[model samples]
Structures are given as structure tokens and as C-alpha cells.
Target: MARILSIVFNPSVDISCDAESVQHTMKVRTHNLKQYPGGGGTNVARVVAELGGHAELLYLSGGAVGSMFEKLLAAGSLAGHRFPIADETRISLAVREEQTRREYRFVPEGPVVTTAELQPALDFIADYGADYIVASGSLPRNAPADTYARIAAIASRTGARYILDTSRQALKSAVEKGGIFLLKPNVGELESIEGTKLDEEGATRAALAIVRRGAAEHVVVTFGREGALLAGSGGVLRVPARHVETVSAVGAGDSFVGAMTWSLAEGHSIEEAFRFGVAAGAAAAMTPGSELCRRADVFALYEAGSRTIN
Candidate 1:
């Protein structure tokens, strides 16, 4: 198995519950509450483990809430190396209103992280190199915009394929610095980077431009229900989205990245890996609240879709 390492700058304890109706000035009764360790890279690692792949996790945590988060993670099959921070890890909530079939999410900006607290993670990445280094999620308040850029540099020096999934200044800075092996950006995020609304043709052109410039070797733009497009040196390949009843859309993107990475690490072709990613994403949507893609569902979907594509 190819060694994989996933890093999360801002992690969270994700709490989800369902309520009949959400109304102001009323005590809403909730049930089916679930809690999970969450963050972009954290979710990626979880999906990898779910698919019988091992990905070492590196993340920052602190305070009482951090302890609670650790317990939740320990309950899973992943073991991680934690870098202590001075601030408490944040808690995010998602409430599903059964009446409207809508999910409401409340997320905090997260605690400020000092350079001192962030350096250890950088150092760890430098010393503990792997086949692939996945840096996902947002930078905590007060972290440098060039943080992911610096990580890209480290991945280059360590001879690891760097995969990045982020948005805003972080994404811009990293792409500007180049050397990314794969860049996964949703349509909205791609639009944010391009600074304009892009139709499908415009989106393909933009992704190819990035690849031609050597900013990234492969660019995958996900369009949710419309499916995803991959642009690389070999040209663009489109994977249609798997239509399924969505229990929760949360974690679907992470599931895509995770399963794709695992497939790549297992020596599958880029096209095969892309198909696995789409399958995992659909499987994740079929699940409830913070839970990622299931292994059996992933393969079933992948095989079924493979036949359709064939």
C-alpha cells in the first residue's frame, strides 16, 4: 500500500441532529443526534480507513473540547499525531429540519493560531514524508495565507505528491506557488479563483490553462449534481454524477478526495481513480449526518457505474 499522510489545520467536533420543525422562540425537540471528528483532511483520512487503506493523520488540537475530539477520533480506526495549540478546538453543528428537509449548519471561524503553534505541523511534514501529502481545510485565524504554499514547497523537497483542497487566499497562494500534483476545487471555488462566472466551456478552458501553466498537473472541478470534470496533460475527462437520494451532502467532497487518493495509491489509473471518487461521493450522500462513504456502497456504486460507462 502506498503511504499517505493527511493534514488538517482546523479540526472540529461535528454534532448533528434532526428536528421536526425549526421555529424561533420555541424549544425544538431533536433526535438522532450524532457526533464525529471532522475537518477536511480528517474526513479524508476517515474515508481512506473506511476503504481499508491507512492514512496517517496530522492535526492540531487543544483544551477540553480537544480532548473530547480525541476521544471521538480514537473510537474510529485511525491513529493520529496531534500538535497541541493554545486554543480550544471548535465545535460545529448541523440540524436537519424534517418538515422542510433542509439542513442548517453553524460553524465558527475557529481559534487563532500563532506561528509557534503552527510550526510543529510544518516540521512534522518535513521530517515524515510519504508518497502523498494531502493538505485540506481552512487555515485558522491569524495563520499566514502562504501557509499552504509553504507546505507545497515542503512536499516538493520531500519528493511527495502534494494534493490541495482549500479556498480563498489559501488556494490562490498555493496555486501561485505551483508544484501541486492534484488540485480539487468545486465549481464555486473555481469561480472564486477565476474571479468570474464560468459556464462549462469556460470552466474547462480555465482548468486547462492552470495545467498548461504547470501550476498543477491535474485539476478536478466538481459540480455536485452535474458531476465533475478532470483536466490534465492528457486532456479533460468528464465523470457524470451518480444520482442517489441524499441523506446529507456533508462530507461528500472529502469522500471524493479520499477514495480517489486511495485508488491512486493502490496503483489504479487516473481515470479509474476518478470513477472511484464519484462513486464514493454518491455513497456519502446516501448516508446520514457527518458519516462518510461506506466501503461496500463505494464498490457497489463503482462497479455499477463502470458497467454503465463501458
Candidate 2:
């Protein structure tokens, strides 16, 4: 199994409820109500684990919610935790309304982690022999925007590749510091980084700019149902995203990045890895919740998706 370390700040207990649709604010019935350990890095770690890879999740956590977070991860077969001394982890909820085709999300700002607490999580990745460090998600208000950049820099020093996925100022900060091996950002995220609107052509151009600027060796743009584009040699390769009756959009991007990382770690080409990523993302959308997509689902989707793209 490959060693993959994921560092997440602002971890949370994700609760999702699906109603018929978001027509009226009336008592929207929930078909499913479940809580899981989630956040970009955590989701990536979980996906990696399901794909038969060794995953070690590192995050800032403390208090009762932190304890619960630990307990939740412990129930699984993953590796160690780098627990910090904080109060309780916050809760993030998603309300899916199929009628109106809307997903109403209520997310807390999450707990503020001290710099004192940040080191252990960073060191955990370094000491754990991580082959790839996935430092994703946002930091709390108290932390600097360059937080993930700092961690990625550390990983580079230790000879570990860094794959980053986030948004806004933090995303910019992460890549500038180097050590970013791959980047998976949606159209919106890409546009934000490029400081422009990301239509189809714009999205491809933006991804290329990131590669030109040397943000990462590979930059992937996911366009939801439209598909994805990879900025690679000669030119950017376009891979059609698999169409699915989307149940939940959350964790879809994480699944894509995780599968791409898995393929890259296995020494696949950029185009091959990007196709696998597209299938994985579609597989995630087919599932209901955050920890939904399984390795088997990804494999099946990949077979069909390969044909769809070719």
C-alpha cells in the first residue's frame, strides 16, 4: 500500500439530509440522516483508504467533538491521528432538495487552531513516511491564509509530493510556495485563481496558466457534468465527465483528486490518470453522502467512462 498523508484544518462532522426537493421551506423530509468525518483532506483520506491504499489522516482536533472525530476514524482501518488541543470540532450540514434541484448547506467556520497545535499535524506527515501530502480545505480565521502553503513547503523539504485543492487567497498561497505535485480545482476555483470567469475555454486556459506559472506539474479542471480538462504536454487533453443522476455534490471533487493521486502513484500517464479521476468523481455523485464512493464503483465507472471519452 502507498503512504498518503492528508492534512485538514477546520475538520467537521458532516450531516446530510435529502428531501423530495427544495420547493418550499416546509418540513422537508429527510430520507437519510447520518454523520461522518469530513473536510477535503479527510474525504480524500477516506477515499484513498477505500481504494486499497494506506491512508494516514492528520488534522487539528480537540474537545468532545475532536474525541468523537478520533473515535470515528478509529472505527476504520486507517493509520494514526495528529490530535491538537482545541475545544470541539464544528458541524457542517447539507440539505438536499431534489424538487428544486438545490442543496442548502449550513457550514460553521470551524474551530481556530493555535500555531502551537499546528506543528504536530505538520510533523506527523513528515515522520509518517508520506509519499504524497494532500493539504486541502480552509483554515480557521485565526490561522494565516498561507497555512497550507507552509505545510506543502515542509513536505517538499522531506521529498514528498504535495497535491492541493482549496480556494480563494489560500489556494494562491499554497502553490506559490512550491512542492505542489498536482492540483484539482473546479471551474469556479479555477476562475477565482485566474481572476476571470471560467467558461469552457477559459477554464482550460486558466489551468494552463497554473502549469505555466509552475504552481503544479499537473493542473486539472473539473467541470461537473460537462467533464474535465488537463493541462499537459503539447496541449490540454479534454476528458468527458460521466453523467450521473447526482444525489449529492459534496465530496465529488475530493473523490476525483484522490483517484487521480492513486493513479499517479501507480505511475499512470497524465491522461490516463485524468480519465480515472473523471470516473471517480462521477462515481461519488452517484452515491448519497460524503463517504459514498467505493473502489469498485470507481473501477466500474472508469470502464464505462473510458469508452465514453474515447
Candidate 3:
């Protein structure tokens, strides 16, 4: 049983390319195309590996695309297994323009995996050994929101805690199970959940509200470059990120979640884990590619310049 298991319902095979410019409603020339296995959970696994922690990526697998995903995971020396599905996996591309310093991306809906495919996958995860489970991203068509909720329940039955991140009914159901220790929801997603406009204050308020509701014991409201606010037993701890040059915005949030989970698994306190996440997010922001961060970079940023939002 790996200590960390990341699950993604909708996985992607990302092929990113750099383009000259992204003018409104116009075709543009692009270069520097590169492809790799993608999706939130896979990204988490990569970051965990970079941080010297153990993580296994469990995702829907089948067809050639699924085979490609398996190959990619194997290349990283990370353990990966497949779930049989009918549809071939989907693909996406990020086109970065050098002239205007802009990027345009082509994204497609991932495979619509069926319930038949999902059950065995869940069964496989039930046998997995992990201290913490990180479930992130959107549900493919036919996956009920509580899909993660059931998995979270499985983790609890198996003696492992889980961090659930997703939007809508899934988010609601997972919180209902009441075993989730930490949850990270963006402002928009939280807004949709609470049925109100969730701005900065509203986001924090929502975090406290969820805590009061007992869906989650601790909550972190991520505000992109604005930093993240933590809502726990001791109230909110605002972790303001230090300024850093950004090459690409891909996987910044995922890096933060992975790092925070890794730190806590490594026996750091909540405050220490918060700092670890801030540095990890900054490290990913400074990296040029997707879901890439070296442990050295995270530690270096931590020592040189990370600060709490006091």
C-alpha cells in the first residue's frame, strides 16, 4: 500500500506547444510541441515523486491512449494500473505565444468512462494501502459526484484519511461522509457549492461554514496568485505567497496540494505543512513545464523567501 494515492476521474494526455500569438478568433503558428501524460492525479503523482515521497496514480485506463499513459507512468518509475474503458483517452494542447507573451490552449472533454468500468477501479483502490488519499478533478460523464465520497469511505474503512477536491454534488457528498481531513476548493467552485458569490471574504466565510457543517475538519481556500487562506480548528491562517516570475501557470495548484499532503505525511505540523505548500506552489510557478518541480527548488524557495500572510 503506497502512502499516497491520487485519483482522477477525468484524465488527459497533454500535448503542449508554443505559438507566436493567440489573436482573437484566428489561427496561429505554434512550435515547441511536447506531449506527456496529464490530469490532476497524474500531476500529483509527479510532484510527489519529485518531493521524495511515495505516490501512486490510479486512473481509468484502456485503449491505445490508456496504453500510452501506462508507458508514461512506467517511465517515471511510478506504479500505475489501468481500468478498462470503452472510449480512448482524450488529448489537449497548450499553445504558448512568444511575441505577445500569451498562451492559448485546446482542451477536450476526457473519456466518458462507464459505471461498469468504475466499479472494478474502485475495488482495486480498496485493496491499496495508503495513509492519505488525494482525490481531485472533475467527474467523467456517468460518475456521480459522490464517486469520491465512496472512495473516501473506502479509505476510512481501510484506515487512511483523504483530501477531496472537486466541484458540485461530488464535493457536497464527500463532505457528508465526514472523514475528510482537508479540502481545497477554488472560489468559483465553493461559490457554486454554497449557492452564492464567493469572493475572498466569502471564500473564507464559506470555509468556516463548511467546518461548522462538519463536512471537513480543515479547509484551504486557494486564490491563485493572491495566495491561500486556511480554515482549521484555530481559525484561518492566510499564507501569502512571495512574488516569483511565472513561466507557465500549469499545475501550480496541484503542486500545492501535493506538497502539503507530502509534508503532513512526512510528520510536519499544519503550520509547517502550510509553509511547505507555499514554497511548492511557488516552485511550480517558476518551472517552465507542467506538473514539474524539483524538491530542491521547493526547499530553496522555502529557505530564501516564503512568508505567512500575517
Strongest candidate by TM-score: 1
What are the models' TM-scores?
0.98, 0.91, 0.93
Off by over 4 Å in 1: none
In model 3, the clashing pairs are: 1-129, 19-96, 145-170
Candidate 2: which pairs clash? 21-97, 21-98, 21-99, 227-241
- The candidate, 1 or 2, that scores higher on TM-score is 1
Candidate 3 structure quality by residue, lDDT tens digits, 201-267: 8888889988987778788887778878889878988877757898876778788888888888888
What does candidate 2's lDDT look like per residue over 146-259, in tens digits?
Answer: 887887777778888888889888887786675577888888887777777867887877778777877788888888888888885457888777878887767889898888
Tens-digit per-residue lDDT, 128-211, candidate 1: 969999988998899999999999999999999998999999999898999999999998889989999999999999999999
lDDT of 2 at 2: 56
The residue ranges of model 3 lying beyond 4 angstroms of the native Cα positions read 23-27, 289-291, 305-310
Superposed by TM-score, candidate 1 places the C-alpha of residue 158 at a distance from the truth, in angstroms, of 0.8
Residue 96's lDDT within candidate 3 is 76
Superior candidate under TM-score, 2 versus 3: 3
Off by over 4 Å in 2: 19-31, 98-101
